[model samples]
Target: MPDITLLIVDDHPVVRDGLRGMFTSAPGFEVLAEAADGREAVALATGLRPDVILMDLRMPGGNGVEAITEIIARGLPSKILVLTTYDTDSDTIPAIEAGATGYLLKDAPRDELFTAVRAAAEGRTVLSPAIASRLVDRVRAPQGSTLSAREREVLRLVAKGTGNREIAAELFISQATVKTHLTHIYEKLGVNDRAAAVAAAYDRGILG
Candidate 1:
């Protein structure tokens, strides 16, 4: 297996060092870089191109959300895993919205953290078990609005990168109906574009 190189992004020196130690001690994982704040995180991540980035949610000079947005917008290949103390539903949704592939608490056990990092490196998502129900709730409740079952099916295909006609063929629905469902999905998710909708779906854990 290839080594999983990680970038640690946290404002606290102690936290960065501690995580670095944990990752280094774990077999097949390596600490590639450390950044004290979001800007530094972006710079180091851009330069070092680590396989995964452990990002703290709160920090100075750009913040984790903005950093994730910037990194993804710039087409960085690294996947971001948010390592934070905040576990509120509100916090969870936005961090995922910001392009985090995984979320874990600061107090997560070493075994869990290692597992999460490994899953993230392998292009799988990881969420803290503590907030798993909250994620399901967020998707189900969805700010007092919901997608129809059919619309959701269409969105799932869209999330998988299928075009309207492809979705139509796959679901045995008309292309026009597929477009209609996409429109409803866009309205419900408050996204103006396909990529935005896909991002929202993944953020809400509606799509893996």
Candidate 2:
């Protein structure tokens, strides 16, 4: 089999160096390039088209999600494997929704990282244990999300800073109906209030 070409995208030089050393030393992998942030990653990826990108989530310029989104939009062949320190829903959900092939934490073992890269190179989905459980819970949640059209309309209005009464007026529905939709939205998004719901919706791709 051909060596799996890789682009390491991370803000920390030390972390990038470590990953470079590890992957370069390992057989069946080739380190194609290194990028300091998402912008650099995208530029390098556009040119190099590596087999896999080991990407970090948070960076000074252009976050990992945006880079993943852009790369997917451009139809780049590289499979994105997010290697980040964050595992929160706020982080993992967006990266996955943005078309990452895998999500692995910084604390993952070297062997596991290598295995994940191989799987990602083949377009398989890989997620850390914690992230996998979170997705499972969301899938098994009681109110089975898959929002109705009217409910989605309410959420869009809510995201745009519209009040319940205003949403009711805009949708030609009563305030009580708006409240019901908000409650379902909160349950589906696993958030308590409006702001959290909006944020979670954006993170999970429930809303744009």
| Per-residue lDDT of model 2, residues 1-208, tens digit only | 9999999999999999999999999999999999999999999999999999999999999899999999999999999999998876668878999999999999999999999999999999999998899788776854325677888888888889999999999899899999988887775666789998878777777786
Which prediction has the highest TM-score against the true structure?
Answer: 2
Worst 10 residues of 2 by lDDT: 138-147
Tell me the whole-model lDDT of each prediction, alpha carbons only: 0.85, 0.90
Candidate 2 backbone clash number: 0
lDDT of 1 by residue, 1-208 (tens): 8889999999999998898888788789989889988899899998999999999988977789889989998899999999999886556777898788999999999988888998998889899988787678657777414667787788778777788888989989899988877776776677888899888888887776
TM value for model 2: 0.71
lDDT of 1 at 24: 82
